[model samples]
Target: MRRFLIIAGLSLAALFGLAAPSFATVSEPDDDPLIDPAPCVNAATDGDADNVIAVCTPLIDQEKTGKPERVKALLARAAAFDRKQQFDRALGDYDTALMLDATKPDGFNARGELRRRQGNRPGALADFAAAVKRDPQHQAARANYKSLALELERLGAQLAVKNKPSFDCKQAKRPVQKAICADPELADLDREIDAAHQAKLRHAAAGTVSRRALLRAQDAYLAERNAAFGRSTDELRAAMKARLRQLRGGKAD
Candidate 1:
């Protein structure tokens, strides 16, 4: 169980690296806590605790009625993108819908699917968890909850590898083990990440990249990689992480 949690955590951390590769078929929601808060939840209510409650309750009891016409349009467009198997666009629509109205768990669930398709399992789990938490009775939220368990398991295993000596990049002179060797994308990512970690290590490795630098790279990487791979979030993230660790000199388990 602990192992699973570790992998999930690590993969989630690495997910943004390969997100541009594309994974739109995963069929989950795309709610980013970092980018934009849910619009429904973010609406400026009367500031009364009760007013806030009343505002949120409608999204559940009224069945998306709280969502504005624009919100609905965005969601519809996003759904259409899903139908066309254009996950990146679908994810964009989902983001717009959530930004327009955060109360819709369905939007969150839908966006989570896009993240999952992009190999962002941790993100998918977070969005799925958020969706169900906001509305326990939501069918989509319920389904997404069940969908994330496997992702969690895969994340855990990858995390174990992350913590092991076999996967540690900082300590490595050469990534000799085939078990440790990463794929092409991961290889590129590894080099990029290594550049970053090297700068942070001890006095900083020569030609090192900073944490701030990685943050910038992370954003572009997520959008680009998610659009590129289109693999199961956890699997793709795991593969990417192995390479990224090598690149960034991420410490092995």
Candidate 2:
């Protein structure tokens, strides 16, 4: 029994001795005050960009710094770099901070603003969307997302109508109509001329002399375009431009 007790005590001592080094290793980092991010936070609050970077860089580089402290340091440094107009460095720090901790919406919003300033509209839109998705109450992110979305929507609508003519291309069978449908610029001119002519007709009283003259002028214009289109496309474009101008002038002749 005595020999068994001796063996058990020795085993317990060996186990504690092995764990002591690990405990010390874990606690040693906590003893170092320099690795704490308090100084970096203070510099950032002071708006002293150079001091923020100087203080935060060392904390960010230290492996002994905890993940939360490292993220704080990285964010502070990023803001400092932004104030200094060191855009690339600021972006790098923002990216690193977000990668380390993606739970914060402010980080995403900041990155989105940076991307916007860099003329990365699509990237900024995506980041703003992410920030809003993460926190619906984030007013800045929501405002940015809404503004960008409306701009894109307007641009999309313009592009959608850019190539469309007033008439349906599928039903066009005449040579001039087919030619107009085939060329985007000619189609646009034709559409504009038609719109201007229609507007003038709408303004004129029905059965009036002016309305009859406008109708005759439009018929004559179409007849001339159909007859001249086979000769030269350049002439067709010029005729269309002249017709558009005449119609827009609100003159019957």
Candidate 3:
């Protein structure tokens, strides 16, 4: 049963297109009091899982430890648990750390990755989004969010292949429109992008410059698509995904 559970967990990670956790540590200042004062800090950051857990557990248990110190220890121990595939324990610690300090992008990113590996796509998505919101420059969170969004889109497309395209095929005037209508996958993508765009508009404040910019950008994207002749299905899909990312407040490809 233990082996089976391990295999099941690994299989779920594969299905989500998630790689194993890289266990990367953010660098702290050499003379920083946080690092220098904490006995478990180095072991937590760089040691093996056993040592990390052993050293961090004490720090976490200390009632007098500062909130920041305790949160760091929790994250370290959580990462150790993650490496050991003790996902429940890892998630608990991550939750505690985040509760103590929701501003930590790394905590959210780590928890998001763990949730993704455990096949909790919605949870992963929420965590990743939170991480990015907390720190837009967080590369890991951005990458994870983009990848998961694309995967989710692909899954939705697969499930709704039988649905009609956003545009009418019977009145299709352009070759690109005709092509999109002919291919179920491309049609699904068209519908998805359209829905996503409309949703973004619905949420945008009226008369705002951001809303106007979005409209202009979307119009430009459409104009470019209409002008491009003989673009492949793959090209169209890529364009749609880029637009979707932009709509989701991510940097365009």
CA RMSD per model (angstroms): 34.1, 9.4, 26.0
Error of 2 at 32 (Å): 8.3
- Candidate 1 ranges beyond 4 A from true positions: 1-67, 158-253
Cα lDDT computed for each candidate against the true fold? 0.60, 0.87, 0.85
Summing lDDT over every window of 10 consecutive residues in candidate 2, give the lowest-scoring window.
23-32
Order of candidate numbers by TM-score, starting with the best = 2, 3, 1
Taking all chains together, the TM-score of candidate 2 against the true structure is: 0.57
lDDT of 3 by residue, 25-96 (tens): 989875423333265788875768998888888778766778988999999999999999899999999999
Q: Residues 1-253, candidate 2, lDDT per residue (tens digit)? A: 9999999999999999988855334444555465767888899899999899899898988878899899888888998899899999999999999999998788899999999989898999999998998999999999999998898898897688676677899999888888888899988888778888899999999999999999999999999888777845788998888898777674442
lDDT of 1 at 145: 73
Task: In model 1, state the lDDT of residue 142.
Answer: 79
CA shift of 81, model 2, Å = 3.8
- Predictions ranked by lDDT, top down? 2, 3, 1
Candidate 2 vs candidate 3: the lDDT winner is: 2
Scanning candidate 1 in windows of ten residues, the lowest lDDT window is 31-40
Q: For each candidate, how many residue pairs have backbone atoms clashing (under 3 Å)?
A: 55, 0, 0
TM-scores vs. true structure, each candidate? 0.37, 0.57, 0.51
